[model samples]
Target: MTRVLVPLLRASCPPGAGGYGGSIELRLPDSEAERLGGVALVRAALRAAARELGWKAETFGWTGTIHGTMVGVTDRRTPPAPFDSVVDADRQRRMRDAVDRVGRPGTPSLPPTDEPSARLPTEEFLTAYAAAQGVVDR
Candidate 1:
């Protein structure tokens, strides 16, 4: 299994107009990332998670393979929160700096992952992905 690296913010036109960016970023633990094998499972689980919230997942930049990760866009059905996009540019810069100082990317890899399928088994992958989203599989 492998950890997924998804972009923090990549909202579509509607979500952007709703001021849905520059929010606090949450880092998923390595243990959690490992459970999801690659981007497909992560995207699937995220889509499932968002569906519960009445939002649809529209992904952009899916390279298909683990190496080609993509960002999932969400429906902006809900009104913008007061805190939405409350973060200032300076603070955002500082956040980036902090991440650069302490944050690390997933284990570096090549065109293809070590695994034959280039991903983990679906069950294991979804389990971890769901857990990361705090979505207990039903």
Candidate 2:
């Protein structure tokens, strides 16, 4: 099964704002970028634009078990929030202990609760994309 990067905005934007050559910058995590390559990231943005216009995903020239990697597109107006953690509890605790050992007081070892993350699993992403594109209602 071919895998494709799926780029999505961290926040909703008004229509036409995310249009082509409009300075919208998309980004994947360092690990993902290393895994997927830069070309795949660009392709994801193109696919996103096409998909946003109601085009079929098949028309994008690849078909298989699509494993979508969630990425964020920077709108340039605001800096993005910290990334969500996929680490296990043990790892998180170890990290916190490491931080504590370093004497970094008041440093948060977990993701902030102020703003929610936009990153979603493939299934949830598809649903959200459909809803955002007006293909379905929540």
Candidate 3:
């Protein structure tokens, strides 16, 4: 089974509001779920690991072939951003710097984590559509 850990954080929002973002997906063979005792177990393991590192974790249902697990310290005091805007480049850079500072020593450098726009998984959706059309293996 493929397992991945994604760091999450509260997006900078205006006064009295906040939102969540920053997540990654883990794509694994479907058979792994049977061996792993289902996604709940995988999610629990991720949460335990995050807790050991003093971070909070959460899980969400998979929308595609890749299942996602979100782990990070929660900032309840901060409000999420409005549906319109979430984060900009400057904010993302600052957030990445903060993570590098607090993250384990020698962690690999992370790529740019900026989301330019709010776009859904059109490509993924199309891939699934094509597979469903019998053009290729699943």
Candidate 4:
């Protein structure tokens, strides 16, 4: 698993008034993420993140979002998936292609495509998303 910290930014907020907020993303092999389920994955990620940062998980103050097999935790609010949030279409396509290429070293990597239908949000993502939204129990 890998931990990614993303600093929050808002145009309407003052430079220092946005609070100490950011997102933590836990990236793992696609198969493992699927095996764990959304709730379990988030819980595990939080514990791992807390340990890495030298903080107690209970006091970590995080909100989470799941995209496909990826889980992201935030200090203030859940962050959108990197592919979904990037403004530039080319960048988004590249991000999508990169994610698709993970763990398939021998296969020839496909070039980035602009087709919206190319986006693949897995069942794991939906379950995790629902859990994050409190629409389902953990």
Q: Which stretches of candidate 4 lie above 4 Å from their native place?
A: 1-19, 26-30, 34-42, 47-67, 77-138
Candidate 1 per-residue C-alpha lDDT over 45-126 given as tens digits, one digit per residue, 9 for 90 to 100: 5555444444544544244334434434454443455434442343465556555555558733334325322132333344
* Candidate 4 clashes between residue pairs 3 or more apart in a chain or in different chains: none
lDDT of 1 at 52: 44
Which window of 10 residues has the lowest lDDT sum in candidate 3? 1-10
Best by TM-score: 3
lDDT of 3 by residue, 36-121 (tens): 45556655654554444333345443322544222122322221345224434434665667686556577765564464321222
Error of 3 at 106 (Å): 41
For candidate 2, write residues 1-138 as lDDT tens digits.
Answer: 011223333223333333221112223344443444443544565457545543333222121213333333322232123221211332355456556555565764543444322333333444554566566653
At residue 75, what lDDT does model 4 achieve?
Answer: 40
Per-model TM values vs. the true structure: 0.30, 0.26, 0.32, 0.25
Score candidate 2 by TM-score against the native. Answer: 0.26
Task: State the C-alpha lDDT per candidate.
Answer: 0.40, 0.37, 0.38, 0.40
Model 4: C-alpha RMSD to truth? 14.7
Each model's Cα RMSD = 12.1, 13.4, 15.8, 14.7
- 1 or 2, greater by TM-score: 1
Model 1 has an lDDT value of 0.40
lDDT of 4 by residue, 4-87 (tens): 221111211122332223233444455545655544655565556545543323422223334334544434332235422433
- Measured with C-alpha atoms, the lDDT of residue 66 in candidate 2 is 37
Task: Evaluate model 3: give its TM-score.
Answer: 0.32
